[model samples]
Target: MGLITEARTEKLMQNFSAIDFRMSIEDFSVRVLNTLTGVIPEFNKGRVMIKSEDKIYRCAAWKGFSDDIRNFQISEDEDPISADDTPKIYRNIYNIYRKALHGSMEDIMIKSGLPEVKVSVVVGIFFEGKIVGKVFLESAMDIDISKYDLYLLKFVSKVSSLFIGMKFFQERERRYHKDIIMAMVKALEARDTYTVGHSERVALYSVHIAKELGLDIKDVDKIYWGSIVHDIGKLSIPEHILMKPSKLSPVEYELVKNHPVAGEAMIKDFPWLDRIRPIVRNHHERWDGKGYPDGLKGEQIPFEVRIVTIADAFDAMTSDRVYRKSYSLEHALSEIIRLSGKQFDPEIAKVAVDVLNRVFPVIRNS
Candidate 1:
């Protein structure tokens, strides 16, 4: 009997068509693997392995095996998929498994409750003529696959390659955008020597705080980007005012306070940055309605902006300035705890201090 019938082949194609490729690469891989395995019964076990930059194939998605097998990898030299573009069948390759896994195949099968593998098919996924990944299927011993089954596997590989390639392209494009933004940050920092590395530190602190607050990856990512450019408006301020070693006059202080509003204006035209506009503009706003530009207070402030607010304040307190020395981590954290309800959101500030203490454990309770 063949792996799939004519009617099942149509059903398989329909399942593949429903895949949403716009998800993150990790998610896309799992979606493709699940759909492929769910629509076919001839295969009892399978996995998708993606090639890393080191030229090793690592398991990205799997089925019917302990997740511990995710650590299993095949070097380029040992991976048969690396040398072949078409589906190839291997029979009883126990030595191959032993070499890669450092154990007998029977040991793994017994431990993982996987049946002994008698026949397996490997299909390579390629993009623009370069091999990128593979799909390995463990076939049931009672069933024999025909040429049509191989053709269907090849079709699935082609679709998987296209989807995976698009995800890689999107990642590259995002990195390019971030590079341009970082250049702008460097330019701003060049003028204000006192705030050198301020944006990056705030971004780091914001990420830690956002994660501690239990925000999802997408929200944490937005907070990081917003924190990176939170002070971008300072670029428009006078150079002398920014670098002044003495106390700023009231007029100079007012100009300095305009930065958040100016930063929002700087990136407002960028539709891609629309999500972070509120964060850039309102990060300075206090919890008690005493902050600059607009006095959005309490819950009126966006949750993301609230997180950045604490991070921005914490970095400023702990960093060296032209006017005063940097505060110790312990002292800075003490101030954060003290002003929680007045300057920062009470809940987020508590989480931030706890997260920062863990990050700087040497100063904990000291």
Candidate 2:
């Protein structure tokens, strides 16, 4: 029994690993149900039903059942009993299982039609310590319940609960991080009202160019973050210089150039921002090493930075600035293309052109 328990635990761990590696929920559910059925052949025709957000129990996966039962749906308040007042085996199992939650000791076999079956189990699924759902299992033949079997059920139940809890917390953490990043971007935008929608436009353009260039998922995520905080350093610059109506003098222009450095410094304490530092610092660097505080040449700047540079420029050219009118989409595209190899990475420039062409039909001039 110890060996059997160990083997089952190992298999369950493997399934959990597959789930943790980002398998689709459907696939994970199927694997879990299969695992459960494999351990107890009497459950060969068992099904796993998930309680959805709408309070509907939907048949997520099953091993065996007629087509009619396989696709069955039940509302939360609806009982599984028949109109004739006869409880089906599944309904009896659910009723008995529900009673277990309250520590009721009424024999399940007394209610179930399968009186010959001697062993029964009720397991709860929990997410964050709250019982969200349950699983029911019964023996097909007379059999004495063993300690090992009970332990196995407990282990499987605990695993399911932990997975659900982890997933819940993971989603919450993702939303929290997203909110923080958005709030930071908003704060930056609020400080410089002239560029209200700048980060969003840059993010959109960066993603488009990333897709056109066939960038990997990691690279795309990096570009997205970079575009959002490209001008974050402007938070450190004086409002008068940032919102100046006329062209910047040499001194003021130099102060503006230092923004990238300032932005980098602002986020340096965050380890996650390390991936985006290059994009923030080098978005203004010219392809020929003619732009910015650090004149990084072609192929010397990070590829992600190069991709964002074109996106940043395209958005800026087509956006209304305090000093000048925005250019038309066609004019912006032409200007970008003309600067390719000199002011922008030629490959990235071409990709940006294709992205703008396909996505924004009306590239309106400001």
Candidate 3:
């Protein structure tokens, strides 16, 4: 009996660990209930119900149980179980344990339809002091579970409950992060109304150029993000300068040109964004060391930044701006080719021209 208890304990611990390591809550619940049924030999059929905020126990995960039992509905309006309904073996246990061990309480119960099945086990899971879930197990053979097995079930329940809690917390964190990023982008958009779709357009053009260049998918995605946020530093510039109706003075132009550096600083602390920061910061740098902020020349600049810069410049020139009329597709393509090896990387400039030609075929003839 002692050896059997130890084996059951080990099996429960292993199942708990596996469930805890799962990436999704649905998968974790399914795996835990399946493993529990396997370890508890007397458990022929199992069903798991999770307590929702609506004060109802909803079906979460189940195995070896009919759809009707698995789909059984229970709500807060259902009265709590009376004292007489509690099983004799679970008399001294708490209400949670009574529901789990006896399978006859209102919170969690299992009624076997087959006459051959005589015993059933229900396990209630408590999280943060409240009974949050229950597992029902049925058996055809009469087998008395030891106290040790009961204790092991309680431990497994606690671990699985914590796993569910952590999953909820992680999902909330992801949404919070997404909300913050969107807010920042919206704020930037409000300040630079003329460039409302600038980032998105650059992203699209950069992705196309990257594909035409036969770049890897990872590199292509990096270019896409870099292009989108390349002008994020414009947020730091005053609205007057950003929306100036005339060409900027030399000093004003210098301030305006520092946006890449400012944008890099804005997103530098994000670990996932670290690789793209340099690309954002140096997108304006010229190949011949004549650009602002950093005059990184030739091969010194990152390849992804170079790709984004060409795409961004093409979109900027072709789109209508406060200080300049939109250039025709032919004019923009000619200007990009004209600046090759000086304003842009010669090789990337060639690829950019090819991409534009393919996208706007009439530009090639012009």
Candidate 4:
């Protein structure tokens, strides 16, 4: 009774690879449960429960159950079942109804008007030596699980655990890297009182434009991170020059213009940030070949860098500088539209003006 054939196993693996685990947890949970039910059609009812920080197992996904089941919880200290790295079978689930903690499964099922469960299987989803989730398969009639059924369940559980582990570690690594970058931005901002929030605003505006242009998630993320650290090279400039209350000398202005190349060089050695080097180096490049560094004209500039360039210019216009007051929102948007074909990519500039018009007003009022 090998229920899980080689072809079925391969199909399941292919399905797993197709899922984008970066989706919301609720969506991920439902997909996982549905994928399992699709493979084993006999298990008419099931739920996926995730372990929360409060040590309670809350149902994250469920099918063929009343809405009341959505609120069901299982305490970590309960005697209903033990979750190890294996699936446990129960000949009669009713026997565990009273064994479970009060107000958990018993009360919820009663209120939901669920029928009697004749048999059930509980599979534990484990990660890093702890049970992170539980998968329950139940039936109203006494059903026998073939050896292949158990093997397939185990395979699914292991695959779920692997994805869960990878997602958790990736999020943690992203957070760690973001923290370091923010700290650098803060230090750089502290050196110039007038530009305390320039980098963050530029990043936010760039993301808005990127999304409006319907860029994919990966490019949107690159635009954001690159914008956040776009001015990293300016950290090497003397504080006196950055905070100068008057117009900069030719030499000082030249030093200021080199920040993009300097910033690119500063982060060149970090493999994780390597992809964004062009963005940091070319955000100031012009559309008509009059800009600095490499003077990349037209499409020669990276698309992401062009996006950040518009965002940077818009924010700088709206923020007060050491030598002048900030421009009005109307003036800034008009200026962006005015220079669309000259200083900026005409297409990105058009999209950016629309996005900034809707987004910046709320930000200014807030």
Candidate 5:
């Protein structure tokens, strides 16, 4: 009997077509390829390739070809469909193309050390009237597959295409969110180019400190993101105050100090981002209870917030300002150690310096 009976194909199709938003594109592709090689006994190897707008074929998944199948991109490759099948396949945008490959599918069998056969069972995936991808399966037992078996392979191809389409939509949504965030960042930088890259540097510095202190993955991620947008509240301050080249008066300094509270308020509606709110609000707080806003001190300040506090200070000291030159690396590091338990948390301050030495060894210049 040929592999992939009608009943089995129906069951597989139902499961594969089910949309899963939790799965990332890479994870979804891997899951599809793994399931293919598992149930279809005759298919000793399998792969899915999709076309991009640039007229090139990109590998989305490949089992028995490489450990990481997402690496390769093939160019100058022809469609796996035959001239006779093209008319039929293109007749319906949802329909798939099937054929026996004597040439094209050899790319995998050759690399995977399978026998170079005259042809392998191949299925071309079609999504919305485009030849977006194709999946190839090589037989292991040298059994001749029945016509129905090929039909089942075509059905599986459609399931793979469904997952890929979902992946594309998910990515588009994320890019939209990212574009909005970046626009805000750009607006802030426009007012004060001196701090153009300050947020990103603080993020990198905090990530290093998180690693040095052995914080778990979740805490590390929150700290990194919070550091990147720590100064977001500064956007609420007047542009003239932010752009001031001279020392701020007491009234101007008070307004500048309200940024941490404003930053927290901006993201208060997002529960998923709650972990970061503390980090942002308390980023300016001191270890001695002398800081503004809430005056959180010692361990009372969120651990991640303390990490960012030290990182923010370091970047500010090392970075150039319109009113003054940056401090030397030696002077900045010395000042941090001297101010431990005064301006910054003593424990986090030590770890911050160690992280600096480990991550950036070039100490000749700040």
Candidate 6:
């Protein structure tokens, strides 16, 4: 059957133009496959798989995979297969992931003695001319792929490689920043023994709340970055007040409140962090207009910032401090509930309580 109709070609071009640059690798993989399968009749069902470090991630799939195929997962250590080995499978083995992945996916159906085609058409996704991934079109009968089809796939794969490679580098940069942020948080927290793991715990709590509130990925990510750095401004505070074993003097208290402003200033120049600044700066702001920095009240706080505030307060109440033992979960929840509309956004606080109880099963059981 002639697969690439003239109209199909135009539509494929249109679909190719729809690829989103800012998505995560897995998301991009799924979107790419969806677009391809949506427009191309020959590409009835296929998927993209990438081997990263220790795992083979079946990042995306469109129809045609059985339950076994849909459930396939493989570890790099088990097969000792390299990206260099992949083409050989397509070229010679025909079912490498099936063998390597323990009969998890396509190979299972193939091995079940299901009737199949002798040939598969695939395009290698390359970065700097080495295959990092692949695009595939599955068929039940041998495919007499045309020159136009090959060229279209090659063009699509080439364009997609740039996007995938961009996502790869973008993820690498995010990891680098994660390490730097964690180190900075560690150093800042090290100044007070009681504050160890504070940022991480707050981040965890904040993420749970963000998810429970049904926030989008970008907003959730912003919450994570903001929560982890909420105390980054404390790096500028003098250790004497930060490590004070007793209640702070009025002057010391005022200085401590300055950390949010200082932290906001420290990160304002980081373009990647521009979206995260509001959460870091206004996390201390109150719902009823009684909070810090600008004392902006109620819905005036960014919704993202409001979420972090509740998470921050919950963690702060639960974690041990130099001057006081951690509050019991029950007590902390009560205190938070009491202050919901006043100290935290009532809606966010309510959802945060549910997330803590449900997501942390220990809290639920206790």
Q: Which ranking of candidates, highest TM-score first?
A: 1, 6, 4, 5, 2, 3
- lDDT per residue, candidate 4, 96-182, as tens digits? 756565544677776643446676788888879788888777766677886666777787788778777777788789999999999
- Tens-digit per-residue lDDT, 128-183, candidate 5: 65666666665444556656556666666666667667666766775675566567
Show the lowest summed lDDT stretch of 10 residues, model 4. 95-104
Instruction: Give Cα-based local distance difference scores for all models.
Output: 0.79, 0.69, 0.69, 0.82, 0.69, 0.72
Order the numbered candidates by lDDT, best leading: 4, 1, 6, 5, 2, 3
TM-scores for the candidates: 0.88, 0.65, 0.52, 0.74, 0.67, 0.84
For model 1, residues 1-366, the per-residue Cα lDDT tens digits are 334476767777777776775666567667656665665667777778888889888888877677766766667776533325577887654445665556534454455433456667788877667888888776546457667767777777878888878877787888998998999999999997878888888888889888887899999989999999899999989999998998999999999999998999999888888999999899889999999789988999999999999888888888789888989889999999999999999999989998887765432223
Error of 5 at 18 (Å): 5.5
Candidate 3 to truth, TM: 0.52
Please give, for residues 1-366, the per-residue lDDT of candidate 6 as tens digits.
544478667877776676677766667766666666665556455656665655554435434555455444555465423433122223223455455556545555564222343444566676666656766655555546666666666666777688878877788899999998888899999998878877877888888888878889888888888989999999998988888888889999998999999999998888888888888788789999988999999888999889888878887888888788888788888888999999988888888888876655443233
lDDT of 4 at 158: 84
Pairs clashing in candidate 5? none
Indicate the residue-level lDDT of 311 in model 4: 92
Worst 10 residues of 2 by lDDT: 79-88
Candidate achieving higher lDDT, 3 or 6: 6
Clashing pairs in 3: 100-122
Considering summed lDDT, which 10 consecutive residues are worst modelled in model 5? 85-94
On the 0 to 100 scale, the lDDT of residue 92 in model 6 is 24
In model 4, pairs of residues that clash are: none
| Top candidate when judged by lDDT against the true structure | 4
The Cα error of candidate 3 at residue 361, in Å, is: 9.7
What is the Cα-based lDDT of residue 356 in candidate 1?
A: 80
